[model samples]
Target: MAERSIQEVRAAQPSRDGDGVAIYRVAGMQHAAMDPVLMIDELRSEQREDFIGGFPPHPHRGMQTLTYMKHGGLIHEDNSGNRGEIRSGGAQWMSAGRGIIHSEMPTVDTRGLHGFQLWVNLPAADKMNEPDYRDIPAQEMVTLAAAAFDATVIAGNWTLDGESASGPLQTLAARAGVLDLQLQPGAAVTVEVAPGDSLLGYIYAGSMLHEQRELGPRQLLITSHGERWQLLAGAGGASLLLLRGEPLGEPVAQYGPFVMNTAAEIEQAIQDYQNGRFVPEARPLQ
Candidate 1:
């Protein structure tokens, strides 16, 4: 197997989204070639604050969205009639397979709110599958403690609590892994990967030394995976999202709101939305 070393770190740029919410784009819509994991948009809001009020009713197809909140409350409603609220340390994992209309607006709160949204892409074979949702509370997240680092297993197969994280919004196992990690200052962790796999690290809080490179909040480190890569926290500890995935190795034809393998399919998706065939009717009042 080959070994990958940390290449370089790029600063995350700020972009605005729904209801004036600011999105510090970590990936997706910004860089190309990274698959399965698209973008990570962070949000914070307060009383009478309009910022990041949450995304209104929108349409998504062929992908999954993971909403993990650190603080505040979020109300989620979808055309499937599934509605719920997520608080701090909770996550709402929704799959927009085939098609789905959804809205995630924050409820009016006094103490404020903060959270991050991660976009994951479904493989071509599963793009037209059925849509679903998984609500995972903080307690449901299997937490593990290492000598210098702590990690929460989100999905796929990971040994935490002496077992693996085999649940919703998890590791697709098609050359992909996502983990939210918190490291104590001066602590380090090493992750192994396949030579053909790509490694992406996004710093959400604090700072870290990524293979001798300093990565701060909202910064991204793109590295090549050969043997393995190491991440060490700087002073004051650090929190990060570690992502690894095998290359799709296929042509990506994407436009506004839709991503597919070919241009013809992209056109078909657009036409379906325009013809009101992709979006379902709004839920009836109780």
Candidate 2:
């Protein structure tokens, strides 16, 4: 197996979204090689005012969203009549196949809101399929533990102690994996990624040494082609998220909440929303 090397390191840019919720955005449409993975936003704050407003009602199309909560909680409701709450250590996966209107609000009077929202693009073939939703509690997430490291496998598979653990999110058009990893001081781990897959690491706590370079909090590291990559935690240890996916290599036309292959498609999405074509009667999930 070949060793993967760090190709670039970029700082997460500060931005506000969803009714003024502050966040650190790591990647977006400008970075094409990151296809299938459109954006990653880290929202962390102990101040109640920072996330109180939450993400009010909004519409999305041609993509899927994965929200992982590390602390605090989020209440989600959509026009499809799906409603759920994601507490600390829980996650919500929503596929906005054709279109959907939804709102994600912070639990009332809750403090210490912290989590991440990742946007994954859909292939053209499945872009307009029926929307789907999944809420995964922390208890149901696969755990991989070693002497010095622990990880929550939200998507894809991981092998530890000679046994394999697979996440609940198995069906994705782009075929991707999401892992939340924590390493103790001086700990090291090597993860295998398939050839031709794009791999990214977002450091959120402490630091790590990758190929002689030190990556600290809020840094996004992109890796070069290889079968595996090694990560070593710094003295204070490290916490990070690992995302891997196959590139879609398709044209992306995005406008607000809609993402499509061309301007015409985006226009159609807008027209659909305006005509109430995407608004399904809100029926609470049974």
Candidate 3:
């Protein structure tokens, strides 16, 4: 077991999306080696005005989205006949396989909105498969508690010190996993990751130390190849989202919510949506 070391580090930048909702762009298409992952957006604000507009109906194809909330929530409705709300500490996973129209509106509350929406690219072979959706309540996540940290597995499996826990949404592409970890002050832990897997840590609260580099909040850290990694908490403790998955090694062509393998495919997706053939009762795989 080798300790994973830093390969790259980028701080989140202020950005806007989905009808002017405030967000921090941490990672996206610009970064390569992030196979299976296309984008990550952090939505955090204490003011209602910053997020009131919400995301109106939009079409997505050839990818999956996972929305995890730390504060506030979202009311979700989609053309696939799925409707629900993911409250604070909850998560919603949707794979817009072929195509789907969906809207995620934020809940009005004093807590404001604080959460993340992640996009994962599907393999070319499965890009046109049937769409899948799931709304996981806060209590549904698997919790792993120890003296050093509290971990919630949201979409995959996690094992620490011979103990294991799995989240409710398990059928992720390329074996990707999402974990929310909170470390106590001066605490430390060694996490196991498979070799060649893409491992990233997004610090949202406090700070953390990795191989002598003290990473602050809003910093996205990408780690190099290794079978394990050690996380040491900073003075006031640390909180972060851990993303791990194997590289897809497939070509990706993306155009704002639509991801495919070629430019022609993207064009086809656009035409399909415009022609009202996006979410029919059933469509044969291409």
Looking at model 2, the pairs that clash are 81-283
lDDT of 2 by residue, 1-286 (tens): 8888788887999999988998999766657657678888999998877789889888899999999999999998998988899899999999999999889999985788889999998999999998998899988988888888899999976543344678888865588889899999989788887768888888999899865667799998888878888888998999999888898888989888888999999999999988878855555222
lDDT of 1 at 111: 66
lDDT for each residue of candidate 3 in 105-193, tens digit (9 for 90 to 100): 98765368899988887888989998889999998888999988999899887776567888888877888899999999988877887
Where in model 2 is the C-alpha error above 4 Å?
159-163, 280-286
**lDDT (Cα atoms) of all candidates against the true structure:** 0.71, 0.86, 0.86
180 Cα displacement, candidate 3 (Å): 0.5
lDDT by residue for model 1 over 68-153, one digit each (tens)? 88787788888778898888878888887777777888876626767788777777887788778878887887666777888876
Name the candidate, 1 or 3, with the larger TM-score value.
3
Considering lDDT, which of the candidate structures 1 and 3 is the better prediction for this target? 3
RMSD of each: 3.1, 2.2, 3.0
Query: Which regions of candidate 3 fall more than 4 Å away from where they truly are?
Result: 281-286
Give the higher-TM-score candidate: 1 or 2.
2
